[model samples]
Target: MEILSNLALGFSIALSPYTLMLAVLGCFIGTIVGALPGLGPSNGVAILIPITFTMGLDATAALVLLTAVYYGAMYGGRISSILLNIPGDEPALMTTLDGYPMAKNGRPGQALVISGFASFWGALFATVMLALVAPALSRVAYQFGPAEYFALYLLAFSTLGGIASNNQAKAAFASCVGLGISVIGLDNFSGLPRMTGGNLHLMDGVDFLVAIVGLFAVSEVFFFIEKHGKGGAVGVKLNKFRVPWGEIWSTRWTQLRCGVVGFIAGVLPGAGASLGSFLTYMMEKNIAGPEGKFGTGVPKGVAAPEAGNNSAAGGALVPMLTLGVPGSGTTAVLLAVLMTLNITPGPTLFTDRPEVVWGLIASLLIANFVLLAMNVPLVRIFVKVLSVPPALLLPGVTMVSFVGIYSLTGGYFDLLLMILFGIMGYVFRKMDIPTVPVILGILLGSNMEDALRRAMVLSDGEWTYLFSSPIAIGLWIFAVAGFIAPVYFRNKIRKPQAVTD
Candidate 1:
């Protein structure tokens, strides 16, 4: 009842003309970015973040727009995966397994409709879960101690490394690198500079959004170069896109089951939507036995993983919102955004700022419906978006990045710094190193340092106190496992196609 009342209040706020406009706009832009290969939700959010700041909109409104974009991108990513056999992100990789096949069979529009519907279902379920459970979950985070936090961070990195990337060493190294970079600016506790190298820009530390743009967006330019002259795929005519309503409703059970699977998969550390989808597919295959064609354009296979991944996308939000931890690369970006807004999203968020919480929840509900409508009737427009020349599109995107960053601080140094980071991003891609860890490092670094310092303060400098709590111990174990597990799975898990250029 309280949840309902709170949600009603949230709807009141979310539906206000201003917030509503932002939500619609966010969904529209988010879908475009999501549909583009190499520019996943994180990059999309990062690029637009500066623009929102420049607008000087209310914090909540900005968040509403950005988050809408996040979900929208999630909604749009399936387009490329289905039509081109190239996933917009790793999570969408599983979608391609069946989605591309479906497109190849002349059902690109159908495959898109199925995936869009699944995204809606998953997102709807997640919104409900968040509304009902976030406050309670936040209370759990409040009880955490430094030891527990350290463990939590450890678990986050290790689990992420173990699961997100194929090479555990590379992942762990990435984790280490991220943590180290987080320590770069001034030492909060000691009030001394450690790694700034006397550059004033170094004192402010790295801007996470800048880092994200470089890694995901700029790196994508390199990837685009790899396949420069390749034309779009055939067999994906977009004339008909009405949902096969009877077919979808008939598979309600599959939708429900996949939603649950995706949610659970998202909650677990190191697991993401890709894993959720893959697992769901295997489950469906087993359940149907030999009778089901399973992978050969079967509705269930597409429905299950699509629902699972989208649900996982929503589920990943739980830890980020309730626990201040991100379960995937994209949510890690969201975490950074929350910090920029000065609204830490965790247990305290529910009690201290219900408006942001409830408003976000309400907006998500609306966005899902919007996605269903857009994806079905307006998909042709989105496909047309793909045909826009990259040369023209890239310049506009670049200008947006520059203008957005300038609006944030109005500092020439910041713009220059962004350029430098962009170059660094380009270099990182050439090395085949994942750029997400660096951004993660920048986002988590300061907070982790503060947590460590506070823990020491409470413990009176007793180092052993870091492991005093069971939760803390558990987190450490998880982190270490995250670091090691990737190595264990490297040989077993097949590597996806390497990013090009």
Candidate 2:
């Protein structure tokens, strides 16, 4: 009953004209961003976050708009997957397996519409699960001590390397780089700077907003120029543009099951949408046995991954809202937004600002519905986004980053720092180093330091205190397992992927 009333309050705030407008606008823009191949959700969010700061939106407004974009981008990824055989993001990679084939089979409309509905069902399922699970999780988090908190953060960092990584060593190096960047500013425990190099801008540490934009957005621009600046994609024209009610109804159970699987994957510390989608696609294929023809443009093939990834996207919000840990790279960018707003996310977030938490949940519900409506009837519009050439798109995105960052901080040095990070990001990408860990390391470094300090203070500088608590010990076990287990599981993830799909 309390949850019900809280939801009512959320609806009241989300129903406001201003917040609703932001949701609609965000969905529209997010779909376009996701339709662009290679930009992905993390880059999409990072690119637009500076715009929110430029707009000077309050916490509620910023969250609603950005989260709306998040969902919209997830939905829109299918556009490229079906039409261009390109995934808008890592999470959408599985969608290409069956999505492109269905398009080639001359049922692009059915594939697009089916994937849209699958996305809707998956996201809706995860949102409901999130509402039931997050509050309980947040309450449990209140009992964590410094040792437990440190262990949890360690678990987050340890698992990041396994996400779509070819080399764990490269990921570790990126994490070290991120932690190194995090320590550049003045140390709070002592009133002295650590690695500021006598620059006033370095006094506050590297601004995460600058880091995110440079790493995710600007770096992509650099990679595009190096790889495919002159290239363009040819989209499969949509024929028989109508809803596939029969197909959608037949795949209802698949959508429901994939949602469950994806939500679980999203809730894990480092297992993200890519994992969710991969697991669900494999699960569905196995259950259907050899007769299912998974790689051959089946409606079930399209539905399974679309639902799983979108569900994972919603589920990824769970840890971020309750534990101040990001379940995915995109959520890490969202975490940066909350940090910049001076709103700390964790157990107290629910009690300290119930309005923001519930408002975001409510607005997300509306955004899911808004996405379904836009995606179905407006499929034609999003398909057109594929025609946007790299030449114009890359420059436009780069300009947004520069203008938005400057408008928010008004610092020339920050711009230089952003370019430097961009260069670093390009190098990292070329070397096959995962960038997500680098972002997470920087994001969680300060918190991890504070937690470790508190633990040391409480235990009189005894290092054993870190493993004294059962919760802390459990986290340490998981962190170790997460880091090493991925190497064993790498073949399992790769073997199931169908080459043609």
Top candidate (lDDT): 2
**Candidate 2 wrongly placed segments (more than 4 Å):** 230-233, 495-501
RMSD of 1: 2.5
Best by TM-score: 2
For residues 47-155, write the lDDT of model 2, one tens digit per residue. Answer: 8898898788999999999999999998998899899888877778888889999999899999999999999999999988988899999999998999999999988
Worst 10 residues of 1 by lDDT: 492-501
Q: In model 1, which runs have C-alpha deviations exceeding 4 angstroms?
A: 229-231, 427-432, 493-501
What TM-score, computed on C-alpha atoms, does each candidate reach? 0.93, 0.97
Per-residue lDDT of 1-501 in model 1, one digit per residue for the tens? 788889897899899988998999999998898887667787788888877777777777987898899888878888888887877666677778778888878788888888788878987887777677677778889988766776776677777766666556666676677778778777887789878899888787767777676666665565566668355554366656567777678668888988888888787755666667776767777888878776677677677777887888788888888888887777887787788889887778888898988898898888888887887678778877766666666666777777877778778887776776777777765665656666667778777778888889999999989988877877777677667755766687554432110
List pairs with backbone clashes in candidate 2. none
